[model samples]
Each structure stands twice: as structure tokens, then as C-alpha cells.
Target: MKTSKGVKRRRVEKDGDAVVATKLRKEFGGLVAVSGLDLSIPKGTLYGMIGPNGSGKTTAIKMIVGRLRQTSGGARVLGEDSPLSARLADIGYMPQEMAIYTDLTVSENLQLFGSLYSMEREAYIKREEALLSMVDLSERRDSLVSQLSGGMKHRASLACAMIHDPEVLFLDEPTVGVDPELRVGFWQNFADLKARGKTIIITTHYMDEASRCDIVGMMRQGKLIAEGRPEELMERTSTSNLEDAFLEYSWRDSV
Candidate 1:
């Protein structure tokens, strides 16, 4: 394949680093949603981006997944330039908003996404069944998504995103609206995904969840203020938790 720059491209393999972004930036009419951000995520690692609302976590993920184009700089996913057609199939994205069909049955929703990837009937069926079990929605498979509760809908949305078994997963506030018990289940699922050699990038506001990540990028005011393992961030700040570590970084950035 050839890029617009006339450079030949290589097929992105499923191993090694999964994402690389350099000076990535995004802007609206008069607002800059992301500014001079750089990111790198390795294969099989679970990385988290944590910040308050409107801090650009969603915007960054959108650009990486090709939903929104960056205003400047560049990013490469799975070794190919991001937003490239060849790379789309290897990426799975679940936005903060519900991205499933409300009128479709839980099973139908999963089937719909599986079909989008042109998955074979047998393969789709196997994946759909496993995902339904993982999300603990096997009993709700025939139920219309509209009839499901908020947390059920969230789980269903996640099932849809994973139906194709994409190599890279981008989830934004995936645990929001979920009960504490279910949140633990969700994290366990995340850990299982990582164990299976999938690279996962998640955005969350939950400080406790940040500790579960292999690395955490703390965002504030459209910029990444700190990037390190959760424990490293805490130790550097002399704080005992991610929340206080983030506050320490915010205070340093302010002054």
C-alpha cells in the first residue's frame, strides 16, 4: 500500500507495540480538545487514561480509532498509519455513549458487529456465545437491548465491541453506570483480555481502576500531565493513592 506521501506501507502485524502517537492534536472552532500529546502502548498491555470530564481522553481515543481526524501530527496503530483502512479491522472501539442498537436483541447486536467484520457464520456464532457468557448476558441474549438495564446495556455494548476479537481495544469510561460488583467483573475481564495477548486502552475517571492499569496517563486541561505506572506516579508524588498523585501533578502543572 502507498500513503499520500508516496511512501510504501507495510502490513501491520499483530504483535509488538500496538499504538504510537506523536504530537497528536485536535481542535474545534475555538477550542483545543487535545494539544501536543504523545502516546505509546505496547502489545498485551492494559493502559489507562484517567482524567475528569472534558479533559480530552475521549477525543484522543476518537482520533486514534479514526472516528475523528487529528488536526496535526500523526499516529500509527499496529504498525500502519492510523485511520487507515487496513488497520480498522484490527481495532475495536466502545465510546462513552452507548453505541449499540436499542431495538436489536442482545444476540442480534453482537451478530451485527460480527457481520460488519465479515466474520464467518460458525466463527461469529462461537464468538457471540463466548462473549455473552463473559458479559454474563447469556440469559438476556434474546432480550431487546432497550429492555435491558443501564448496566446490562453497557455490558452488551462491550460484547459488541469484542465480537470480532480485535487486536487493539479502546474503551472509554467502560465501567460508568456499572455496579461495584460488576465493575470488578469488568476489570477481571480486562485482565483476561490482556492475558490473551490483546492490547487495551481504556479511559476512566475512577482512581481505583487506574491502579489496575500497566501504565496510566494522567490528563488535565487537554494535555498529558504525567505518564507512568500507577505506583511510580504515587511514589514520585509521595502520595498513597492515584487520586492524590494526580492532584500532585495538577498542582505542579499549575505553578
Candidate 2:
């Protein structure tokens, strides 16, 4: 009961879209998690989706990644429909919860993901080394995930997600629990991945991180209320920061 003005939208179509959702909807008994959502993400761009907790960010990503079934409508990734198993090898996903094997050493977990993609031993090792270094976990490569601190486990999970060098990455709050310094490094890593032509979509509550993305979508009550370049959004809302812009949009949407 808050939103009022409808935000301008980008034209959404399948062509050139790395991920596309059309009239996408999801439900859980009486709760409507997502409602008629339409999203378009082009290839090789860093897109950030920001919203309050339970705003349906994770649900949207899971539907896009084919991890969850939608109650209605559809989504396509890399030109294929949902459940993109054929393209799974080309996609990377770092969920909100740690997905790495806790019983395995950092190195072993990386290797397992690499092996899943049928990566050659030499290639796997080479990539593992670089990822470990990128995540600043080289010193902890032999450390068991269960023994590592929470932040370290988060980093290891990121490394595992990127070990195969997927063309597209869906990172859900990748910087959670990370220290400021390490968070900077993670953004740098994301920048490097973007420069390498990877399509990266990240969901975060951090307004600072939203400014770093090439484009951002603001979601509220399971609906996208606004989508645009961060600066454009700020200018439109007469806001000085993304947080303000988000509030303005959410306010507009609520009425």
C-alpha cells in the first residue's frame, strides 16, 4: 500500500539477453513469493538486484538458475528455458548460504567443482591456484572448510563457484560477513570477472555495492519497482545515495 509512480523500464526480449524472465510468478500455498516479474539481463554486464530481506531476490535467482520451479510464467537463460541443465556447465552460482563442502579442504572443494565440469587436471589446478589467490585463501587452501572462520568459508564458497570459470555468475550477497578490506577485494574480483565478459548478477542489501554495478534493479514486495543505472536512479529520485533512491522507489511503489 505504498507505491505510486511506476518507474521507467528497459525493453525486455530474449535476443542478447543472458537471462530473461517473462510474467514470472511463484507461490507457496497462500504466500505469493513473486508476482508477474519481468527481468532482462544482457550478457557480460554486472547487474545488481537490491531489496529488503524476503523481497523475492533469492526466489527470482533460483527460478532463473532452474533450481526452483515457478508456479506460472517462465524464465530463460542463455536462450534456453528454465532448468538450464545443458548450460549449467557455463553458469556459476554462489548462494546466500555456504555451499562448499565443510568436511573438505578448500583445495579439495575447488577440485570437486572443477571435476564436475570435466576440467582437465592441469587446467583445474591452474584455475584453482588463481581463484585461491583471488579470494585471498592461498594460505588456507589445505584448511578444512569446517575449521575455517565464517568469512573464510564464504570466500571458499566463492572460489568453488568460480573454479570452472563459468560464463555467467549469480552471486547472492557475496560480501556478507566480509570485512571492509576483503569486501573491496571481492568487488575487484567481480570487476575482473566482468572485464572477462562474464555476465554477473548479484543480490545485495548493501547500497554502496549497488553503485558499483553497471545497472541495478530495486525490488519490493516480490516485485521490481525500478531498474536503471545507479546515477540515473538517484537523479530521478532526487536522492544522494542508492539507499535513498531505493526508499523513494519503494515509497512510490507502495502507494
Q: Estimate each model's TM-score.
A: 0.92, 0.94
lDDT of 1 at 225: 100
Per-residue lDDT for 108-137 in model 1, tens only? 888888888999999888988888888889
Worst 10 residues of 1 by lDDT: 6-15
- Return the clash pairs for model 1, or none: none
Q: lDDT of candidate 1?
A: 0.90
User: Candidate 1: which stretches are off by over 4 Å?
Assistant: 1-15
After TM-score superposition, what is the CA distance of residue 243 in candidate 2 from its true location, in Å?
0.2
